[model samples]
Target: MQQCKLPSRQKGFSLIELMVGMTIGLILVAGLALMFANSSQSGNELEKSIRQIENGRYAVELLQEEISLAGYYAEIPLHGIAYSSPAACETSALGFSLTTLPMPIMGIAASNVSEICLTDRLANSPAFVIHRLSAEGAPSNPASAALGTTYVQSSRCSADGVPFKAATAGSASAFDLKAIDCATTNPQIRRYVSRVYYLASCSECGSVSDGIPTLKMAELRGTTMVVAPLVEGIENMVLEYGFDTNADGQPDVFQTNLSTTAGADKWDNVVAVRLHLLARTIDRSADYSDSSKTYQLGAASTVSGDASGFKRRVYTSTVRIVNEAGRRETVSYKPASSP
Candidate 1:
């Protein structure tokens, strides 16, 4: 009955209200997108960092193991055996027989070409060489061994050691222990190892185009020496030798460069080695840059970061040759007793 004049029902939101609501919604969506993008980028960077660390640590351990084994030749003292000259020592691209001159551990200086031990040196980077008996250790001759397997026979146990000719397809299995002479029994017949660790050109791999570097080693494979990649993202390597110059059996001097002629006298005096490695991320950083950063590898070595946008780190270790040091304690200099 009462036709009350009700307020006109609003048909829909006004144009201005609709626009304001749309703008607010857009702003919220934009904020969420920005957060998600940042989180994804951070995750990618973390993954890269972890990969680099793993590779760097693995590479260093590989080198350390080999370096520690340098100069080890069963129980026989390699340094005690003297050759007529360096030529009598078997030589190869990757390795040479350890000589009396202490060639078990050799180095190439970064700056001086004349100080290099390796015939071909990598420019502006130092490298090191190591020689030792294979890690398989001295194994009794197998009934039939693989082509690359190393074996050892030593009289250190019972009778004189057995002597066998170089491994061949035919000779690998057919050695007559009865035919071997008693005087030749002590001969140490084991797989020999000569390895050179260095930074190598990565163009063959995908890294060079991507600005990444690689660590490589030349090791004896059968009768041939082959070079293979050890790790990626390694930028540089620096080495120093610690010498027992005073015959005290303790390191009295540490030097980066040693010449065969001038420093030949001190080569056999090497007791320990210092290793420095520079590692970098494989991918460039989108937000961060590496330019203008100088990394210190050791007391005397420092490398500047490039303009490329990548992160880097330095790894270092000082390793002592137990085989060498253990034998030298007889002549080791004991510090004078202080009252």
Candidate 2:
């Protein structure tokens, strides 16, 4: 037999207490969420800024590096080569064959220069062309390299009949030159280079409609100028040419663009080049405004970026044409080695 006894008083949390506790918890959670959201947003903005800086600086470095190699003609002299207009896809219209002197560095509107460059270049921006041969040589046997590839051969033997010859094979006869031996023999072959740098209207198909500008290049692929994208978010490019009026290898005057083809000899005299690049953030920030912003691209031009909603930056660099300018700086007159 068992006797059941129940005499205990039990109490549970009231609805008001439960509701107050939940409200406090909700308020704390809301505050934490807002803080996290703000942190994430700040981090995102910082990432955009870093990307913008990296793109601008990288673009400047690329220009400085490549443009420094502007007039490198292997064993040949930049002063000795003739100037020529570029017919982007023509091999016969190759290096310096048309002009009276060498035009190592020149800038012209992308739309006006060649169709292969850009269909929609940014504001008819000047596409600067850099003429040189590759620092690295192709296979000694030109037959072993790509058939449609362009090549340059500089004659070391004065008796070879020409300073340099540029051509593409199967035109192997064009590479017939002597290598200081004065014998009709194997010629050292170098890849010919003519790179046209410009600012394009768009970088990719997704950005084509909105037109996120990009820095691009049109280089010789066979005889045709083939366009390739280098960096995205490049809005514009400006170049100031420093020409040497005197033969002292120092820049005497600076010009934004040369006058005419008759004065293209000035291009050969380019001792130094000042480059300007405008870079933009790829995305728009809802928290930021890019209203009434102006960017200075050297002494040449000033660009307006009014309410574009995109953050922009300008990068600048000065590169001296080492092969051309460095060569003329020598004081040696070959004073008959002290007998």
Candidate 3:
């Protein structure tokens, strides 16, 4: 009867049915595309963060290595000492001072004036010379000999003792001497020369005049050497002196800058140093600017304005210059019986 004609049951799907099926398929495809896009973005961001962290960590390690070695060969004579010229040399410019002994003990009397120098013998000719001055402080112009006394002429020698000149003609405030008069009767004056060198960033970096930024180590002897780049993004480096004044205990003077005029006296009591470094990222990433997003380092700090879009980070560390001589002397003295 009406049997088969059941209206061919519309052999194919109705337009409405087809439209619904198509819509469902489109939704699934769109969702998959969105997921893939999100995954890719997340991966890129993760990679960028890891890189930044690695850079920062590397910089910190480098600084620690150098700073830990501050006054490495010798101990800081005092916490803080004013860079004032000797009363007799009043007209002379004041200078800061520190002391240290030579790496090798050749039995040379520390008194014998041997120029405090850095042997770049490892490098080519032109080794650096660090002159030990018998002055109260560093003169404004090191070139002027009137400011201080040129005690020793430090020369760069090979393992064989061959002397070499440094490329530049300058002096180093710090030094490594062969010997010091530890038995001196004068308690105020330190027998050993304090070789103090401040490792800081010079005007060379970021300056149109000085090609690229480099790590520089300056010594009281009037020598400056551009060492290898410790880290790329280092913006500024500062060193503070902490002194343990008064035999009673604890350091007293905390000065940001060291004076050439004043020997260790500026911080003669300084037993420790507080080092600070301001570093920035060499490569900036766009993802970091998003306000809604956060990184492992926390809220991203931009350079200057939104335009420059640079990021900066800072780190700090403190180091103590142990008195090797003091330790040794203490070990030698067993609280001698009152005579």
All predictions: root-mean-square deviation over Cα? 5.6, 4.3, 14.7
Computed on alpha carbons, the lDDT of every model, listed in order, comes to 0.64, 0.75, 0.37
At residue 302, what lDDT does model 3 achieve?
A: 25
Error (Å) of candidate 3 at residue 28 is 3.1
Superposed model 3: Cα runs more than 4 Å off: 1-22, 74-227, 244-250, 263-270, 285-312, 323-339
Number of the top lDDT candidate: 2
lDDT of 1: 0.64
TM-score rank, highest first? Answer: 2, 1, 3
* Alpha-carbon shift of residue 144 in model 2 (angstroms): 2.0
Q: Write the per-residue lDDT of candidate 1 for residues 1-339, one digit (tens) a residue.
A: 889898997798889999999999999999999999999998999999999999889988988887788777564434445422221123433222233322567665566555332333346776766766665744444454546543433334334232223233235333333323543333345565667677764624442353347887766566555667778888888777888766556777777766655352456667888888998888888767776789988788889987677889999998887666666777448899999
lDDT of 1 at 281: 87
Question: Candidates sorted by lDDT, descending order?
Answer: 2, 1, 3
Model 2: per-residue lDDT, tens digit, 132-179? 778854535666646787776677788866776766767657578787
Q: Give Cα distance to truth, residue 339, candidate 2, Å.
A: 22
Cα-based lDDT at residue 16, candidate 3:
100
RMSD of 2: 4.3
**Candidate 3, overall lDDT?**
0.37
